[model samples]
Target chain A: MTQALVNGLTLGAVYALVALGYSMVYGILGMINFAHGEIYMLGAFHGILALAFAQHYLANFSPVVCLLGALVLAMLFCGGYGFTLERIAYRPLRHAPVLSPLISAIGMSFLLQNYVMVAQGSGIRGFPMEFGRRLTETRFSAFAGAEFSLLEVFILATSLLCMAGLHLYIYRSKMGKAMRATSQDRRMASLLGVDVDRVISATFIAGSALAAVAGVMVSMYVHAVKFNDGYIMGMKAFTAAVLGGIGNIPGAMLGGVLLGVVENIGIWFLGAGYKDAYSFIVLLLVLIVLPRGILGEQVSDKV
Target chain B: MNITWRGFSGFVFVAALAFAAACGPKGGAGAIRLGVAGPMTGDQAAFGEEVLYGASLAAEEWNERGGVLGKRIKIVKRDDQAKPDQATQAAYELVSEGVAGVIGHFNSGCTIPASEVYHQNNVPMLTPSATNPDITDRKYANIFRVCGRDDDQGRTAAEYAVKTLKVKKVAVLHDRTPYGAGLTDQFKRNIEKSLGAKAIVYYDGFDDKEKFFDPYLQEIKKKDPDLLYFGGIYHQAGPLTVKARELGLRAAVMFGDGVINEQYIESAKEAAEGAYVTFGPDPEKIPAAKGFLEKYRKTYQKPAGAYSIYAYEAANILLASIARAKGTDGKAVSEEIRRSPHESSIGTIRFDGKGDIQGSYYVMWQVRNGKFAALQ
Candidate 1:
């Protein structure tokens, strides 16, 4: 049970990173950004590429430096991808009927998935396990039956650090203030001299960057990435976002961790095969009983 | 437009037949084109490329030996993308293109549907990898597979667990794919036959897309099964073993041939050690495969994949059957294939009545020193 908690927390941190993207995008644009998962996938790919580059070009760098460098590079690339995706797929359909953007998001998701599949040969690309060798190999017991490792600690620490950084930026930064204003009332914020486009764009970039961190962390954990991996991860994270309250930022975080715990517990009690169904079950329950989501309904507008 | 279901299907079938007739292989002395279908562009392209290389190498060697019946062999490639619908389309396209036979389609899901098209068109289809028993159980005279069926491998694994390892209280899991589920089903059946119904403490399937297995491991640990048999491909198997070891689940990990690839080791790292998987004898180690391996390395400049030699042997047998039958006639060639004992790199090949290879080749392989070592 204790080990389940450790596993759930690590898994939840990754989900939270991704759920933040969906939450932020939906909060601002009223669009799901279905392609958000693909951004995460690309982040993994970019991080892998960055790792290869670092290993090849800067052979003397420590594993920590290499991992952090890859994370930063992946974040930057995914942020740019998110910005471009909004401009190409979302921005054009902004003024169209609501259905158009949703359709566009779905189409954009397919397009990005296929693009990666075509470019990368649809095979599971294995990450070299050499990085974080010590972290992964070194083990410590948290309790009698539960074991912990440095890699899991690193994953949790990075995720919490990113969350903290994001919180400060949103609550303290001027641009974040403009973003919150735009998300609350796009036309009103525009009328009040806020650049709606820039704020929305910034929202996408931030969400994508967070998801990129998650992508890198997951790649490190799983040691492989495939073209269609983003689809399921994306759906689960979306569920997390919706479960927490689609537009609620902290709700997304709570929902992510909760969903992860529920899924792990479900696997523990039921079986491993029903892991995905547990998340969707949560989605259905949240929809039926708590429609606005656990956090989405209770908290409003302060996304 | 006036249309009825029967009439529409009739017209479509007639048109397809006419098109096939129009483009069917001409009785000429140019080349014997064999359709090679697999996921050439999508995720399984690695295996697809192996299939292509294996068939092409066989074709090239046969051409050098003065060709089969004075005609050089030609390989017509098609990318199935590992999708069932696309595989049917590729089969149709191959039929219309007038290939003598097909040596391809890595996934059983793809192979099963594509076999129907081949059966309808009288095109001999030989799959190198697709190991699901249904591919052969349908009794399609035109369809055959080089690899052992799922039941054979699964039975081997079950017996190995019971007889050799003396394991009790086994837990079986699958990915719910045809290959994965079918293998586990067979294992369950055989295991029940040996140890009765109560032996399997847990039997279930999970989504292939699932990444986390901690909770499952934890729950399974409580069951305290002596063996955990995973009927899935390597990608999932790798992580399962890693997580099992992480959770301190001391149960012996066993898997199907799908987990025989090197990527399993790469993902599971040291955890792959002591893990057991069922597979045929390693073709790379056999002395009979030296020449073929040499040529394969020289031509492709890479190590042969799991199914490469199987594809090579399939191609060799198919062409030899054609030569012995003195034509590319489907029924005649298939009969010849069944009738003769052909010597090849994988060993002497003999087909049973249903076109399944005679006898079982499966043996338990344990991951030792980061490599699959056949257990003595």
Candidate 2:
């Protein structure tokens, strides 16, 4: 039971970070950024490439430095990717029918997925051992039967830290206020000199960076990365986003944690085959009463 | 509304494209074209490339000896993308091209349905890796595979678990793929037969693309089974093994032939140590295979894949049968292949009535120091 919860939290933490990005985009553009998962996938690949470079080409770097370096590199790369995606893919189609942008998002997702597959051969790329093997091998017990590996600890701590940082950025900062305003009313925010374009760009960058954190952690935990790893994860996080109320920040987090716990517990009762089915059931049951999601109506999460 | 030169040119171009499609590359100018089909361009491209390269090597060898039936043997390749619909399309295209026979299809799901298209068209289809029993169970005289069936591999694993490993309270998992589900069902049936129904504490199947196994491991951790069997490919198995060990799953982890790829050990890393898998005896130990292995390395400038040798033997047997039959007739060539006993790199090949190889054996292998070694 203790192990299940910890595992759920570790998995949920990554989902929350991914949901945060997903929610931010939906809140601002009023469009689901289907390509967000692809951004996450790209981040994972970049993280591994950076980690490999640090561990092999560079000399005498500590594992922490290498990891942090990978995280930063992944964030920057994906942050730019998100910004450029908005400009090239989303921005041009902004004035078109809402469905047009949604379709564009889907197209962008495939484009990025294929781009990664082409750039890096479609083989399952492994992480540097200093990071992947050494980390997972080192484990510490939480209680009598509960053990948390370094990879899990890293993923949980990093997700919480990123979430906290994102929360603060959205609430305590001026740019965050601009974002909230834009999500509520794009034209009005633009009329008020908020630089809605800049605010939207910032939103995508922030969401993408958080997704990068999740991506890097997942690749590290699994010890490998693949081109299409993001598709399912993106969908799962989107479910989390919808459950918490599509655009709600805190809702996305809560939904993520809840979905993860439910999935793990579902396995406990139903067996492994029902793992995915449980997620849908949770969404349906929750939507029956709170359709917008648990935190769907909250103002803070809209940003 | 007006008929212009531009419209006329576009119409003419479209007509030309259709005409070209209607008659594309007929039998490579009098050569006996053997179609090579698999996912040559997608996620499973590696396996398809192995089929191509391996069959190409066999074709090159046969050409050197004097082409099949005094005609140069030409290899025609098609990309199935490991999809059922695309596989059938590849099969249709291959049939339309008037090929002698096909040696391909890396996945059992693709092979199963694609075989029907070949069967209906009367083109012999022999897969190198597709291991589902139904592929042979259909007893489509036109369909066959070089690899051992899932039931054979599953029974071997179950027997080893019950007797050699001395394990009880088994947990079986599959990825719900035709291959995975079929193999897991066989393992479950056998394990239950040996240890009784109550011994199978947990039996379930998950999606092939699923990444999380923590929940399943959590439940299995509680069940505390002595043996855990996964009937799936390495991508899911690797992470599942890593998580199982992480959650302190002490059961002896076992896998079917799907884990033969190095990616299994690569992804699982140190956690893969001590885990067991069932597969054919290592090619490294086959004395007859020594020359082919060496030649494969020398010719390709790379190590042979898990299915490469099987593909080579499959192609060799097919070509040799075509030689003996002295024709590209599907029924005659397939009949000859099933009837004759040919010694190849893997071993002596002899097909039963259902077009299955005789004496196909599965051996237990353990991962030690990040590599699989056949248990003595």
| Candidate number with greatest TM-score | 2
> What DockQ does predicted model 1 obtain?
0.49
* Model 1 TM-score (2 dp): 0.86
State residue A33's C-alpha deviation in candidate 2, in Å: 1.5
Clashing residue pairs found in predicted model 2? A249-A301
lDDT per residue as tens, model 2, B186-246: 9999988988999999888888877777667767777899989998877778878877886
Off by over 4 Å in 2: A132-147, A298-303, B1-29, B41-43, B64-66, B70-72, B81-86, B223-226
- Assess each model's interface with DockQ, reporting 2 decimals per model: 0.49, 0.53
What is candidate 2's TM-score against the reference? 0.90
Q: Rate the local accuracy (lDDT) of all candidates.
A: 0.86, 0.85
Worst 10 residues of 1 chain A by lDDT: A294-303
Per-residue lDDT of B25 in model 1:
49
The sequence of per-residue lDDT tens digits that candidate 1 reaches over residues B1-376 is 3568889999999999888776654543267888899988654567788889999999999989988998878889999987789999999999988899999788887898999999998888889888898998988887888889988888899999999899989988888878889899999999999999999998888876667665566667879999999988787888788768755689999998878777788768888899999988887678999898888989999877777899999999899999998999998888887788889888888888787888878988999999888885
lDDT of 2 by residue, A201-300 (tens): 9999999999998999988776678898999899999999999998888999999998888887777667677688998999999899887888886654
